[model samples]
Target: MSTPKTTVHYVEDKINSWQTRSPFIILFLASLVGVATGLIGSLFQIGIAHIISWRMGIADSEFSNIYIKCLVIFLITAAMGAFSYYLVKKYAPESGGSGIPEVEGALLDLRPVRWKRVLPVKFFGGLTALGSGMVLGREGPTVQMGSSLGKMLADTTKIKNKESQHTLIATGAGAGITTAFNAPLGGILFVIEEMRGEFSYTKSSIKAVFVGCISACIVYQLIIGSSPILNIGTYISVPLNSIWIYIFLGIFVGVIGALSNFLILSTRKFLDLFYQKKEYFFVLTGALLAGFFGLLTIFLPDITGGGFLIIPNVIDELYSFYPLLILFSLRLIATVICFGSGAPGGIFSPTIALGAILGVLFGICARTIFPEYDIHLGTCAILGMAGLFAASIRAPLTGIVIVIEMTSSYILILPLILTCVTATFIAQTLGSTSLYSEILNNTLDKLGIQRK
Candidate 1:
């Protein structure tokens, strides 16, 4: 009996030793990935800004006329789009979607992590597509590239443990969002909310994600100077009576969000049918779209890029409701076509913008119908943001966190909660799943890609 007791105690000691060692090692390795993700993310942002400024400088110089500037922009964007299309079509076709979905899939061993191909392709390809003034956001590409970088480090260091590999992947992703918006809490929330299906949320993983987010934010602040992406001014708190209005706004956004997703899926299917495995068709289509958008950049700059610059203007009433509506509709269509065409762009920012527009319209209507409430249109704008995004993506928590982080208006959390929850419920009741997951599944179906 004494010998048996001694053996059991020895086994217990070994288990405890392993448990203690694992956390320490994971934390240390996760920190390394965090620093790399932060540095790479910061550099990527700076690089894109520099590219855009340089092109604009050349356009402003005596060497380039109006026609010459147009020509240069067209060629640059066309070539960029063509190259980006080639990479997505040939190397990692699964990378065509928002990349968030791919990360989710990867966690479940449902997708491969081609770090070597994806990291470079998404980095430079995203730079080209974004810098060319395509209506794309850098956030999606950054997340994909950040995750790839994590995979690269794991492979290079001969990380044999599956848990270790997955931990780094999530860590990098958190860092990516952190760097993208200079919002650490948002980064953590994104992983927890959007990637819930894939992320293995453990005590250590949560802590690691937090660490990565903070580190990435520090790097981004150092480079970008710590400012909110949008300066919509301070917002008045939403009264309890006015909260129901946000719910109604959420329902309206839900309808629109459902329609937006339907269109995107339909457009994707049409492109698949038309292209019919012809890579050139894909590349040429991208080039043509890029050229057209580049032209818009020169003529009507409001209709281009991720639409961040347009939000504050709209909120400030810089554009009349009618014009804003028209612009909103046009951008909606452009966003669908551009994203559906798989042009290395993201619909995230555009979706938020669309929601803002809808909210503004709703607010104006509410004010006219019931002027005694002293309603603020900007609050509706914020609510609409969470609502549309929640309705479209079916991730209300993520939408809420993202909007709050982007605008730095955490005071409206209650309204945001009401809007996002209402929108998500309505959208689901009306039959729409998460947007990114749907797109990822569609892409996988087209490619005949599968995971056991």
Candidate 2:
């Protein structure tokens, strides 16, 4: 009996060794992560939309008075903000901010994973914060949550190898982007460009990221259908002579981008002062600010949410120069306030919207200034997308690819590249740190803020 058991164990070990070394098996598992991430991310999006719409329905009716509406929106948003804060304060403080930093930190093994706590806290907490109408992006939270899912998969599979662990984390991050944008290439580029420091980028890791992004995209399309997130119609590219305008636009965006980063960091510093010892007041203030945005949504409508709805409107020449300027100014302030409040949303979408508005304004002004040079508003809008993203995040390649994917405007690649490069250079020269890393450092300096 002992001899027979030993033989069986030896055979099993041989089989396990072969399976572990099989490239195909690794690829298959990575693809599995993609599918899971895509499905989960899509569900997350759908869930958030449902919640937002439901809340809006309640706010739109029965609260006819502007003052009353503002008050109610404020209270509701405050509660949501407070709830999000409490979750971060209690369970996974590293889950706060954009979450991309935590993902990066995880790759460096500087963070600990309590996915059981973070995954739920970020998901539900994010929903509450985002649904409250703060000017936050969903992509950041989604990335964190998706990566957490990857870690979960690794744990369940008993993957002990460091290489496999890195591969899986990359898989989750790629899947998160794919699910968010339905752009597989963009998702992969995100890992390469935005999280380069955290990424190992071995052949194996690259394959895993590729597999995960593609699978997530497939899953998302199966559910949401393969359509660009923004349904902007066909846009004619700017003429070669007109391309210089985009370069100039990029330079302008660089200055604004640097300023924008400064403003955001400054806002955080200011808000931190209020929240440091006064936790309840801090939470309440966040709620009140969200409520204010909620009321503004009902009244202004253009200044609320993630700012996606406002992009097309800004680019379509629906408003004149002065009005566009006003919109830009107000939205910028609102964006800073909403984002600085420590909500579980992203600044990506909002920054895109801001850039679009700036481009449109620049286009209108340039066209008026130079009648001989025909300025394409749509082209400006696209450039704006890349420039703003590059300026704020300091990741030009990711910004360019993401905008292209979101708009399905591959024809603008040259201008996009030029503009993104210029924007990134300008922002970097001005000395603004990458947004996610900055946020992560902020969270870490606070004692008890453990990242994973």
Judging by lDDT against the true structure, name the best candidate.
2
Query: In candidate 2, what are the lDDT values of residues 1-452, reduced to their tens digit?
Result: 56988999999888788866755666778898888888878888898799789878867778557777767776776677778777877788777777887788788787766789988888888888888787888888778888888888889899898778877877888789878877788889989988887777777788888988998998999998899988887777768987877888899899899999889888988888877776576567766776677666677878788888878777778898899899999889988887776677778888998999988888888998888997888789889988999999988988888899999999999999999889888888888878877876776776456554
Screening candidate 2 with a backbone cut-off below 3 angstroms (N, C-alpha, C), the clashing residue pairs are 73-291, 74-291, 78-287, 137-346
What is the C-alpha lDDT profile of model 1 across 64-119, one tens digit per residue? Answer: 36788788878877887788788888887756756887887788777888988888
Residue 11 displacement in candidate 2 (angstroms): 7.5
Cα RMSD to native, each candidate? 4.2, 2.9
- Distance (Å) between predicted and true CA of 348, model 2? 0.9
Off by over 4 Å in 2: 1-22, 62-69, 444-452
Which candidate number maximizes TM-score?
A: 2
